[model samples]
Target: MADKEQFFSNVYDVVAAYESGFVGAYGNPEAAEALRDQIKSAGGIPDGAMACSTYKLEETGKGKLSLPFLEILKLYPDCLPGGAQGRGDCVSWSSRNAALGTMCCEITSGIPDPNSGRLEGAPEVTTTARLNGVLSTEAIYNWRRHGGDGWSCAEAAQVLLNDSGLWLRKKYDEIDVDFTQYSARNAGLYGSRTPPESWRKIGENHRVQTVTEVEEFEALRDLLANGYCVSSCGSEGFSAERDANGVSKRKGGWAHALAYLAVDDRDEIKKLYSEPLVLIQNSWGAWNDGSRRIFGTNIDIPVGAFWARWSDIKNRYMVAISGVNGWPPKKLKSYGARGFI
Candidate 1:
């Protein structure tokens, strides 16, 4: 309890300083001063704090504010950082839970097949032959002229809620899922364009395949249990469900892919796919959307993003692998420890 309380207090101090005007200069001297005050109030020493042990001091030996802030971050990993690096751009389901996170929406806009060998650009490749333009056009058009209703991350959350029956409003398990309510409520408060009532139906005709929207948690869980990860690159290559040791399983979708670790006591997920936790592999390295900003902007999943029953998992990631050359040796013990994918 003391640990949790201390963590919250530290977060409050950091947030208060940022909101007060310490971060006002947009990374200028004034912002640094506000940060210093914030750190002092939060019971941190300023001069002694360093950005990182490895960061070389500036040529003139000037003390950098970002460094101290980074040190504070290292000390209290969960506290909101000094600036908006972890903040989100749009008010969506994520904002209601904790600090508004930095946007990591990789432009699935125009990515192409990796094997296509088309070097026009990364974004161009992703958006190609994908629903990027269609989805964007529909969303933008609906938001602009038609009731300001279009697709957004919030809408996606709503769809998840609606299908999961969480929108029906009984007793909620996923507190973060409740932020779906903000999609419209905050939309009104912030006076931003509202998302569309419905989204373009994902279909084979649209070059997108979708399962029937389901609501049963148990059934959803079942689907996820059987899903095999597919590459986002849209190539014939598919990722292994169970790793070599057969503990973690790979979960992939159109935008990103990661390995699934064990579930928590509450049945919450713990991903092992990415780094720092589990790395969520984005086609766009660190620069593009959906990527982490470890240096500047990045996506770091602490508690794992969302939980889906095996049914939903299967619907999201189902593939059939036929030919394979080499396979890993049998390791049943590892399977039990990690839950083979």
Candidate 2:
């Protein structure tokens, strides 16, 4: 059996490969609504969404490697495979979001005084830094080229905050920290700056649900505030011992994100994720360590417990999800100092 570290490392490499196109990940550049319409025209929800293959479904009921999963591909017909203007399909975001979420959960399972799993070179901005203003603007520029609403960084922050249950009830730029802009900035910056916009709103009023304790659901709640889907221990909590079958279980709110798709209530929620929901996209690869599902949990950060780096989260065990198909590109693998990819 592989060591826990090796297992996660392998998972990251595969996820990264899929995202970087090493494994033929595809998508369309059309708007999400458009793609949704196309799927509806084709045959409604695809039966293969649960298969875990990064391919598209054709009318013939066959699977082929193509851009955009069935759900979001149909809408973005113009979205080509590998280009500056390429837009990610919904599956792309789902996979990436789930993998990252899972990694976070694995490492932050328990609050270590000095957290592990932080990115090495991320800037250590103060909690109240105004860095989000720049990040929100940058995200708008990046996402806009791919066919998103021409939202400003500030606007994005507000949306993120509102989504996370922060109650950001103000117009763009009018609110100290916009949820839309802040949510994007949080993931992109990885907590470097909570966006002064958020700081101002949270100033002296650091009160949000499920954050003070740093439990699984609590951390997930924070992730939800930022606009990412979350899956976790399902209130089952964490356990240090492997189960009777030698499988480790994620009991409580371990901070992590794995890839997963949301489903309708009428369907038989398979319950693959954690306790609260079904399905979890793991960065730890195929071998299940008994973790939670990857959908319908909170992943937004509460206003107060937002940590700037993995270290800020005050836990050990850095979990990484890669968008590459082969070995992940990390500092240790860099042989030369060219400083260029």
Candidate 3:
């Protein structure tokens, strides 16, 4: 930013992501990843990753939202025990609970993209979610906290990939939490250190199989468009107050993590945000104001979600996107035959 730089010193073949062939609107899934190798070889945003691609709209994926997550999250507000956090466990909340939960729901009960006009085919979520809802932040936070206030998304991802697998809310199959219902107090207490071995064993059954960083904005869009979830930690700051269209403007930088559940790159929203907006689901429940209206539609997004412009997220801010097994998302153990009371 301070100095105008043209090239990157080297190139990196980014690790592949969501290889089941749900590449965004792009023809080749590898196109965005290929741009990376040359950038490091050619250097610098491939002639500027931020500026060069501004307003490069994807007509197909405009206004993508995770409706399964929205309805389920609201159906069970108990899934979010404490509305806001008094400690620093956002890394777990963002990556584990919000991001992964969204992906899991999409896999298990996703409706055809809303644009498909097939809302009638949505799945029955009452089997597991009616009781405990989704993954527990209490089970996830402490492992990454390392007995401190903060942790990185990568550390949290490793815990999911190799350490302890996912732990559904306490009501169902809890990890190490002492109480049953989602507990903010428990989340704060475990906000540090690696979890106990028992937690590791319990979590394995539901662990996510893949998590890779996304460099290209559209690639990240594809992940969400195709029903994947992403968590990003960065220095970017944003306002809690949203505009009429539900867009949040840059306020400064907050060294924290948050989950992105949806992306709206529709050509029409530009009149309001001037660029595409990604809906960020914050760890602090009901913290941001204003409601999100799907662009060009009368449908209103439920509370607890807000939109952030892409311009605010370009470059330097790395995104960790994730997905589960199978094209339609397999049934996990948390809700195995023993599911529900």
Candidate 4:
């Protein structure tokens, strides 16, 4: 029997081949059919191989390859390295507010702190922690009821970091706030709208250094490489279609905020087919076929946690945030151009 690592390697190779247009062409019918024939001639995925859902197969044409990739990784829970499992939980609040606290915590304190009693370095950031770090949904609700209104991505990001010290994990009932009443804004300059003075009192230790106008994916990649997760504002209209297996696939969409986590370089595929993808940690729960539950027990994981095309990012507005102990030197050197201290 093949060991798990070897099994995963085989899966990776299959995916790389598919992405390289060898097994099946992605996004092309005739090419996909031709490639499928080639794969059959070469003997299809080996018997006893893990199978991906039909939806993933149709969407990426490598569903057979992709599904197993995620599943195999789950088998080795210890495989995730330092700070890899950011925040340890998914937030299901409004897209506008759900990610702020988690993103802030991820970029500032490092997820899964070894001292926090999690999976060694994988400390879980509670949903309560996220709520406390940001402007509470209760505040947003009250503001709107009094006719104050919505917040911009920048506002959400800034307020959370600026008030990190004041963040407190309250009982579920006390913090169970609603975001449906708030409106959403696509853009805002970091720190342009200061958080209310009252909310700003507690987070003296948390500070933000904002980097804006980052037009290149390489910069985003570099930031992730350096342990900094970026908060981006982009169109949410990206269609999220699910296959018969209920695995979610991204289409196109309008504006929203997302925390950029890691990138699956697939260097071999990029060298041959130019299809590098980004991994985003979404506030939504596990949207993939309902197989694994990400956060402790919540199953309604958002559908936003999925791999996305680089082009999808290029067509949208983006900004990167670096908190204290999280700032990369490249970002620091380029601060003169569109950066805010």
Best model per lDDT = 3
lDDT of 4 by residue, 230-292 (tens): 555554433344333222345544233455554444554355336656555443233233322
Flag regions of model 2 displaced more than 4 Å: 1-70, 76-159, 162-193, 196-255, 258-260, 264-277, 282-341
- Ranking the candidates on TM-score from highest down gives 3, 4, 2, 1
Tens digit of per-residue lDDT, candidate 1, span 242-323: 2322222333322222222112112112233222111222111121122122222243322222222333333322111101
Per-structure clash totals for the candidates: 44, 82, 14, 22
Model 2 backbone overlap count? 82
TM-score of candidate 1 to 2 decimals: 0.20
For residues 151-212, could you state the per-residue lDDT of candidate 2 as single tens digits? 12112222222222222112245443442323423223212233344433432221111111
Candidate with better lDDT, 2 vs 4: 4
TM-scores for every candidate against the unseen true structure: 0.20, 0.21, 0.65, 0.43
* TM-score, structure 3 vs. true: 0.65
User: Comparing 1 and 2 by TM-score, which wins?
Assistant: 2
**What residue runs in model 1 are displaced by over 4 Å at the alpha carbon?**
1-145, 149-206, 228-341
**What is the alpha-carbon lDDT for the whole of candidate 1?**
0.21
